[model samples]
Target: MTKTTFTGQRHPAASTEAENSVNKVPTETTMNQGGDSSHLSFQLTSHKLNGKNYLEWAQSVRLAIDGRGKLGHLTGETKKPEPGDPKMNAWRSENSMVIAWLLNSMEAAIGKPYLFLPTARDVWEAVRETYSDVENASQIFELKIKLWKVRQGERGVTIYYNEMVSLWQELDQCYNDEWECPKDSVKAMKKEENERVYLFLAGLNQEFDELRSRILGKNPLPTLRETFSEIRREETRRNVMLKLDSNLEGKNIDSSALVTAKNENDKKKKPWCDLCKKYWHTRETCWKIHGKPPNWKKKGADNRGSQAFQSSSEESGLQPSLEVPPFTKEQLELLHKLLQSQLQTSKLDPSTPTCSFSQTGQGLGEDDWQC
Candidate 1:
């Protein structure tokens, strides 16, 4: 809008007093300074966009970046875990913008823990680009809230989430809660986990008589979850080993927890040896059968004080020949979280009452046991 003013002195005309008439240009609104409304109109035509469009739309998000200059995520975003330097857990507590975005990303995608590591980086970038503009776009600052409904088509284990999201939800809830899943399903997963573990241990055995016949023909393919589980177990085993070593140097390394050893002549049979052809020995004591000299020390073998025991005529001291694997910090954290959540949920379960027969049967003799 323009300001209008009438000058006091008017031009004098000869016949009649003629007043000057002029029109002031209508003022332009601030919206015309930088052309944006036009492009915004075009942007609304598309409902679903790709990663590129998503990034462009980020410039319109509302930002509350702190003194550190990090921006908050869109309101409708589901949170994801912050996959950062493992040592930065404590650091993130003071950085709410990072944590909040991570959480939103996780929630939005229902992402698996393994998937979050890579997605976390993109999430932060998305939040930053979404909030570049401070005004005129606040109404659409938040990400779109597109939703979908799950419907059934056919029954099978091979269907994708788009077809079976609801079924998985029922199973996934057990991640934290101990609800009763169908016995068949629980039994099946447990059986699968155990069978996978057994096959893995069997594969580790160096002296399987028919490794090719049993394994190569079977064509077993390890799953992402199974591989992850084994990786975690081995890692925890390594951690326990390291902790034991740090606390027990100069002490005997106990193999009981790791592997059991016993003589065949003992009351019960012990786990057999791969190298030895005897009943009373393990792979550790198999030198007697392998015909190796008692003092024999294999080259490149772990010699963790095994030399302290002098070899007989040809018995090498037992040592760990297998390479130990290390665990990632995230795996350790996941295990700890799983255990803690399980423990908390277990304590919340109602106890089953037990009744004794002796406490019942008023009409019966005191000597009778009847409920």
Candidate 2:
């Protein structure tokens, strides 16, 4: 009267429902242990395959898959197990996970057709066959033209060098030739490297003209890497020099502007005299009100006029006249008083006859008074 469980052994007349439930249990368990849903949903690369970027996209996919230790799934190194093998369910789960990663890393349009591929290898091979252009002569030719025309125009040395190196690597993939002899291969590589060095030098901006000439003048040309490093160092030096020159120029402009402003302010601050209608002296110091002093004529004459007078006197053999001091204020007052007293005396004495002052300060006649 004991009941039998299907887990122990499969009966010869096992029902379809019992077989399906048994198969589902192990498949679900294997999927849970071998491939998490998160792992299947993860995007392999930031760049999606869009037919044109097949080489770059393939490289990314390979790196991502290899990192996950499931590269053998795509490479066919992990062969499929026969039915009923203990590892068959785990292998299936992992393969399905790899397929999901591939689809997730492709463009929607490019990935849709490959969605139902039977295996990871099938999907990878199919995509590669459709997009790989390794043998396209026209593409190689276009790349060569672009490499020759690439210039450092307004770009940093690092960025320009990176761009050139990427192009060179792509070209290398297209022309991967194998030499039978090791020595011949090394010689060919040297020749190719020399050409690359020339191309790199030729593509630099005019500012590196002198450095490029020096690099080219060497009997044994430097390697491409050595040439790049040398040029990069030169670029760094030039940038520093330019920055210093700019700073010096700015300082010079600031100093000159300050000097000009100070001069203008000094001119504006000078005293103005209303009486003399001149600058640098006020009405209190006007020469007209103070009367002329000793050497006044010489002081009034400019340097050029004085020099001309001196030269003329030397030529004529005449000594320059000595400067005479003007009359003092006390003497001027005394002279005025004497003139007034003399006029009064003349009025008082009719016999003396009225003495008249001369307007020109000279005696009009022998009886006239002169001052």
> In model 2, which residue pairs have backbone atoms overlapping below 3 Å?
none
Cα error, candidate 1, residue 12 (Å): 86
Instruction: Count clashing pairs, candidate 2.
Output: 0
Best by lDDT: 2
TM-score of each: 0.14, 0.62
Q: 44-100 in candidate 1: lDDT tens per residue?
A: 111112333332222222121221233422232434445775646533442443444
- Candidate 1 has its poorest 10 consecutive residues by lDDT at 14-23
